[model samples]
Target chain A: MRDILTIEAVEKKATRDGFGQGFHEVAQSNSDVVGLCADLVGSLKMQAFIKEFPERFFQVGIAEANMMGIAAGLAIGGKIPYACTFANFATGRVYDQIRQSIAYSHKNVKICASHAGVTLGEDGATHQILEDIGLMKMLPGFTVINPCDAQQTREAAIAIADHDGPCYLRFGRPGWPMFTETGSFKIGKAIQFSEGSDVSIFATGHLMWHAVEASKKLVQEGITVDLYNFHTIKPLDEEAILESIAKTGCVVTAEEHQRNGGLGDSVAQTIIRHNPVPMEYVAVNDSFGESGKPAQLLTKYGLGIDDVYAAAKRALTRK
Target chain B: MADIAELKRIASQVRRDIIRQVHAVSSGHPGGSLGCTDFMVALYFAVMNHQQSFNMDGANEDVFFLSNGHISPLWYSVLARSGYFPVKELSTFRKLDSRLQGHPATHEGLPGVRVASGSLGQGISVAIGVALSKKLKGDTQTVFVLTGDGELQEGQIWEAALYAPHNKVDNLVVTVDWNGQQIDGANDDVLSLGDLEAKWIAFGWDVMHMNGNDMEEVVNVLNEAKDKTGNGKPICILMKTEMGMGVDFMTGTHAWHGKAPNDELAEKALGQLEETLGDY
Candidate 1:
């Protein structure tokens, strides 16, 4: 297994690229695996799958709701379908399609959502949907995942195919630092990058890299904080969360999403029910994002390493 | 065999079940349920060659989706009579802790229901998805979906319509129950779906129209649709049906769209249709 960091060396690669690659790889091994895109072949990085398996790739053309229906139909005939589109269009735009056709029916379909959160820079508020996680996670029998990096996204693509029922795999457009090694991915398992009993930071997607950076800075200051990468948001590893909280007594959750229903809210709900712990949420504060570079938006919206650092400090004070 | 007579007998039995089920619950749509009885009976009994038992995967068997799921009384009746589940369960429609809810849902782990579809205009999409899946699996078995004419106003139906023909989903046979009435009033009165057949044909579907209440035509047209499959295009059959059939008081009116027949009205309705298949 190649290390995950080496896979990340190819800079400027969108997380969607990982999905496209994994899709092509799965198609080669399992002829039953097929790809569908809603006129976003180029945007969702599904061109590679389309080019490789022209017979298996379907271009539904600018209709997300229809694409979802088509994908569900494909699943009924025993084909594993990965429906690709932007995060906003995939979840919010066609939520009813997913709910009735896929989730309600328990269809084995993968909803691969690209350009998730504010990282889809320059598209502005209309394209930037910070509530997709909430929309998808709330559905019964729906598994929600936000891979930390490109390599993890690729593994998630293959892993989700093997699992039955509906799933929403969210990834971002902007490429960040890749920290995990290739082929070392596990679903629904939180990876602890750093360990400390003082405060635990649970983060996902692009925010995972930011949490890592903050951990390094905090380590220098002699504050040993436990850092966990929560790639799978739904079917969350509750045991891991409670174990960490039992040790830390205080927790900080981070994601590039709205504070209301994203990873922060999920963690808060779980912590309150299981373990009563002091926590701080590092997310886009009940607001929308505008057109800007991905890095600038992260900083401007208080989702950068600085925010994670501040949140860690706040969580420690609560402890 | 006289297809119309056989279908009418089956439909009469289904109608009795529909009224009995709704009357037992005191809530459920009987207007559309009764209206589409002839269509459902002809399709299940004479049209599709499905297995005796229901299978979710449906690998080698023909599949059917009730897109206008508000007509679950009719569907549940036909499925039970067709041996998908126990006929005794028919009395549990829309009751507390029953497998049958107001809208059809798979949450109860019902054998025949593949998807939950009370929210209008979603079943056609799911049926299309299942048809696509069947093609991918190399299964030649066809998928049939039934929707209401009023339900066509939903934008998602058009979205799925555009997708089906573009992808050459030839295994799908979509039927629109043109009852001409919705919950409020006539479909034209609510939101005019001008020239529905023309719209489907223009969307690249192989369009056909038939009198849905006539069981012989329903079966023959459906057979024609099955034979027309694998021709690189999806098939759509526009079925012109009465809002209520068999029951004299309910027929030819939208007033019974969802109104359950009371003890007096139920007696009147049941008098027109004899219980040939035995009431649940």
Candidate 2:
């Protein structure tokens, strides 16, 4: 396995920041691209876009449903609208608005959600939305993408602008490590960051860094493991996962979302359909997230690096 | 151009189509559809400068959205009669594999519908988006949307109501079918939407009220709405209408809000709504 632990003290930046940068850049070139933020200008990192193009940016004052409806309507007028808000409000609160107006209508709206999962620390379960993936991916034709780091998220946001359809781009609050290379994000393809043999550890969103760290620890312990970034949860890269797990004979899925309807569940379904393997999940169990620091929350909710290592070990044992 | 008499005749035919369409399916909302018949017919045939051949972008021409989409029967009838589709297709409403869904939708390539609107409180925002688009493109064309008084109870409606006028989405007109009836009894019984006109006025809108059932009054208000556009404020027409206007037994109550009439009721309703323009 490749040594991905060299950058132990790397500069940290929130994935939402990447979204802001990419959205602003995309809006500059594509005159038809517009943005609507539901009163989370600062948290969602949309100040730059709003600053650059005041005419195109809409401040929809804490009303996520209205923002979604407006985005759907904007799609009809030949404008690609990006609706930004917290994952909780973007999915759970305004789900029906997205379903009827955006998803069912097949509006060309980009639902850019920030502060997803337990990483949205100190806000408790109400703000930390662990179930947005389930809500979004279940909708027909909704392309669900959860980019791992800052560079990948920037590329993901810019990429969705070119693709035509309703999409849910989920990002987190924590200033994660910029581990992946710039412009490395692909829509439906998995990135094999490191190769191994004993087990294939698939991680997504903020969990990718932790999984990488866990792999380093496992490698020191003489356990060779394969690491794959399962960022785009829907339209999942099943071929890559099946091929990797076929070689490894076991798999461990990790995400900052819930154990039931997130990356873990997605991998399980794919593997069950194509190549059944002994799989273990390193994700938040059935309980809701609580107020704490990102690291504390990750460890408390069983999504820390230790959890990934433990889950990988369990998958290897099971196999 | 449709004369007052011709517009009234078209409305009567639309009412007939609504009844027949709902009765054929035995499912779908007919009360609201019947109530908003005149306004829809007036807007499409006379008021809005829209094309008979539907275009999704709606560039250079005015566009319409049915926010209270339970009244899909009304919109489908108006679009068909106005040449958006085959008038014969009205018979396939609510049937399996029909483009005329239970609610107005853009999917299935329904020509007239720009967005899906069965779930209430969404149409106004979409209209605001289209209006904003026109503003961005410097198109100067207007966008129109219709909502129910009951739909205003939805919180999203309040959010959109606050959004449009605040943003100066001036080239847009919203008409609330203040029929006073919802699926659950009257608006008073279901939930009192007290002082609706006052509410819109407070929300920074150009508010106007008209008797929606009166074809002449509806036509006059709609024409006035066009003149009122581009005045730096969103237009709201608080249109008062009866639940099932022309049908005797179905009127004055919310029981028939979603219920389709039986064979006898359909016959009686169709008898009252004279097919001035031949029915589908």
Which ranges in model 1 have alpha carbons more than 4 Å from their true place? A1-12, B1-3
Candidate 2: chain B TM-score against the reference chain B: 0.98
Local lDDT at A273 for model 1: 97
| Tens digit per residue, CA lDDT, model 2, A198-233 | 999999999999899999898888888888998899
- Cα lDDT of all candidates, in order? 0.86, 0.90
| Cα deviation of B177, candidate 2, in Å | 0.6
iRMS for all predictions?
A: 1.7, 0.7
What value does DockQ give for candidate 1? 0.69
Cα RMSD for predicted model 1: 2.3
Question: Looking at model 2, how many pairs of residues clash?
Answer: 0
Off by over 4 Å in 2: A1-9
Docking class of 1: medium
Locate the minimum summed-lDDT window of 10 residues in model 1 chain B.
B1-10
Top-lDDT candidate index: 2
